[model samples]
Every structure is written in C-alpha cells, then in structure tokens.
Target: MTEISDWRKRIERYRFQGSECVKCGARYYPSRIKCIKCGSEEMRDVELPRRGRVVSYTVIYNPPKKFSKYAPYAVALIELVDGTRVLGQLTDVDFDKIRVGMEVEATFRKLYEYGEDGHIVYGTKFRPVVS
Candidate 1:
C-alpha cells in the first residue's frame, strides 16, 4: 500500500476500530460513515471485542502472490463476543486442532510488506486462546 493510504488506515490496522450507529445500535468493523440499518450519519468509534469463537474455516493451499508465502494457512469466520462476525487468518496453533467453536483472540502481527521501500504492513490475526 502507498504511504498515504497506510497512514490513513493506521488506527484501523492497529486498534481494530469500528463504528456504531447511534440511531439503531448497529456496529461494524472497517467503520462506515453511514449506518446501513438506520441510515443515520450519527456514529461513534468503538473498539471491537478481541475474543471470539471460530464459526468456520478453510485452509488455503493456493493463495495470491502477496500471501503465497503463508500458503496452507487457515482462515476463519469468527464470531466475536459482541456477536460481530469477522474473517481473519488463524495463527499460532495446530491446523488439525482447529474446529468450530474453538476459542480465539486477536493478536497483532505483520501482514506483508509493500512499496519499493518494503514498508511492513501490520494487522490483527487470530490465535487460539491459551488455557
């Protein structure tokens, strides 16, 4: 990503900032300017819940060029404690042990490097919650 775009998204990348509609109490990740539920411009920034459960998942054997180095990684549809469903890559656990309803939590990690300067992009990924 370009430096300008990365700067603009730093908060979202690092903090898991989302939006909540003041009118209807709807919430979204990747914050929206307008509420899709109530069409209200009144919104507030909110931090998403870090803990969640795996709803479903898949192992990607062939990924895009940017992510090919991490091929065969597991990506999961996670339902957060607040009932927000998010898709994120699962890490730091045995692939065979992954299953529906497995507890997980968000962990910040490197996404990839881009641009001629090799700017490292960081973001959230999910790992099994330690007992």
Candidate 2:
C-alpha cells in the first residue's frame, strides 16, 4: 500500500466514520469520496466514537492461512455509540468470554508481518474497555 493508504488504514484505525449525503442522508463505511446511496461526490469526514457493544460474533477456529497462528480468535460486529456497526477482531481476552452486548473499545495492534525486512502491519481491533 502507498503511504496515504497506510496512513489512512493504520493511523486512522481508532474510529471509523463516513459522511452522510446532505442530500439523501446515507451511511458509509471505510469512507468514500462519493456517497453510494445518492452518488454525491461531495461529502465530509466524520469521526465515530471509540466505544461500542458487540451485537454479534463468531470464533474463527480455522483462520486464514496468514492468520492461522491466531486461530480460535473471536471476531465481532460491534455497534458504536453513534449507531454505526463495524466488524473487527476481539483482542487481549479469552474468546470464550466474549458475548453479545459486551462493551469494547477501539485499539490499534499488530495484525501481520510483511517480510523479513521487519515491516510490520498494524490495524484497529476491539477490546474490553475496563472502566
């Protein structure tokens, strides 16, 4: 990925928000320059809240080839405070303890390795937000 893509995907992992079409009022994820619902190129960037609750989830017993080492991990669809739903991996906790409605917080962590050059990839993940 290019520098901009890396910056957008890595540094901006804390929260996800997209512009709603001022003309039609639609929601978007991963953001886009154009509103898919109304095809309006004019849009704005919105920052979503950091906390959310798990609405649904699944444990990946057999993960992808690259993620096989991290098998039996939990992934969830979380609904943020702003009502935006997103899918992400649950981190730093036992998979069996995860459940629907469990509160989580956005966090950035290492996702994978690129090559022998020590280039690491990082992305956003969710974890139980201790009060």
Candidate 3:
C-alpha cells in the first residue's frame, strides 16, 4: 500500500470509523465514496460499535514477515451490533478459549513499527469482553 493510503486506513481502523449511506441507512467499513446499496452519494461517517461477537475464526500458524512474531494467533470475523462484520486479531486471551460466538470488544494495540526511529503503528485488536 502507498504511504498516504496506509495513513488513511490506519486512522479509520484506529477510530472504528465506517460509512453510512444517508439515503438508505446502509453502512460499510473502510468507508466508500458512494453507497453500494442505494447508488447514492449522500454518505455520512459513522463510528462502528466497539463490541461484537465472533461469528467465525481461524488459527493462523504462519503469518507474514512483519507479523511472523505474532503467528499462531486467531483471526476472527466479528459481527457487530449494526450488522457489519469486521476482521481483527484476537488477543489477551488463550487460543484454546477462542470459539464461535465468543463476545469480544475492540482494543487498540501495537501492530508493528516502521524503520528504526520511525513510527510505531497501532490498530484494533479484540479481546473477550470481561463481564
């Protein structure tokens, strides 16, 4: 990804911002220029629900280069309250305890660092919502 778009996506993920079509009330993640459902350009920015449930997940044994250190982690598709599903890394819990329907909440954590003395990137990770 280009540096500019990476910065743009980082902000959206960190803030949980998505798009909601004002005309049809449809919502999207990573946002969109136009509503896919209604073909309307009247879009509004929406902050997504911080909480969601694990609808599905997979254990990744081999991650990419930058993320190899965090391999063998669970990546889950969480269904948010407003009907949008988001994919995020599950953290702060044992892998054995992860399962479908597990309730989780978004938490910001360090994803990676750039070159030495460069910026340290932070993004959303999910953990079991402690009750």
Candidate 4:
C-alpha cells in the first residue's frame, strides 16, 4: 500500500472519525464525502463513541504477510453506540472469549510495518470492554 495515503489518514486513523449526513442523520465510517444512503452532499465530521458491541467476527488462522505473526487473531465488525459499524482487529482479550454481542472499546496500537519506508503504522484496534 502507499505510505503517502497512510500519512494522510494519520489524523483520523487512530480515532473513530466518520462522516454524518446532515440531511438524513445517517452515519458512515471510513468517512465518505457524500452520503451513500441519502445521496446528500451535506455531511459533517463526527467522532464515534469508543465503546461498541461486536456484531460479527472471524478468527484468521492464516493472515496476510504483514500480519502473519499475529495469526490466529480475531477481526470483528463492531457496532458503535450511534449504530455505525466498522471492522477492527480485536485484541487484549482471549480469542476464544470473543463472541457476538460482546462489548468492546477502541484502542490505539501498532498495526504493522509497511511500505519501503517501513512505516510502523499505528491505528485503532479493539479490546473487550470489561463490564
């Protein structure tokens, strides 16, 4: 992947930065310039809540080259309090204990080293919110 794009996303990469449609009050992650639901150009930036519930997940026994060391890890689709769902690697909890409906929270951690520049990419991962 291009390191330049990573650098550009640094500001919002470690946070739940998403876009909200002012027209329909719809929200999205991996922020979109236009509202996908309402086709509205009027949108605003919103920081989603850190805590969420796991909607779905899968354990990766085989991971990509960069993430091979972290194999047997869990990636979850988490639904934020505001109902915005996003994918994040689940960490800091036992892999077997990760289940649907489990509460989790956003965490900033090193993702991996990438590109020729060897960028030690840092971004949001998720951990169970011990209730």
Clashing pairs in 1: none
Q: Each prediction's Cα lDDT score? A: 0.89, 0.76, 0.85, 0.87
Show model 2 residue runs off by greater than 4 Å.
1-8, 14-27
Summarize candidate 4's per-residue lDDT along 38-79 as a digit string, tens digits.
Answer: 899999988878999999999999898888877888899999
Task: Quote model 4's TM-score.
Answer: 0.93
User: Model 3 reaches what TM-score against the true structure?
Assistant: 0.89
The TM-score, computed over Cα atoms with residue i paired to residue i, of candidate 1 is: 0.92
Instruction: Sort the candidates on lDDT, descending order.
Output: 1, 4, 3, 2
lDDT of 3 by residue, 1-131 (tens): 44566687887778878899999998887789999888999998998898999999998997777667768888999998788888888999899899899999989887666555556677888999999
Number of the predicted model whose lDDT against the real structure is largest: 1
Scored by TM-score, the top model is 4
Q: Each model's RMSD to truth, in Å? A: 1.3, 2.7, 1.7, 1.3
Residue pairs in clash, model 3 = none
Specify the poorest-scoring 10-residue window by lDDT in model 3: 111-120
What is the number of backbone collisions in each predicted candidate, taken in the order shown? 0, 0, 0, 0
Residue 107 local lDDT, model 4:
91
Q: What lDDT tens digits, residue by residue, belong to model 1 across residues 6-58?
A: 78988887887788899998888878999998899999998999999999999
TM-score of each: 0.92, 0.79, 0.89, 0.93
Question: Could you tell me how far off, in angstroms, the CA of residue 80 lies in candidate 1 after the best superposition?
Answer: 0.6
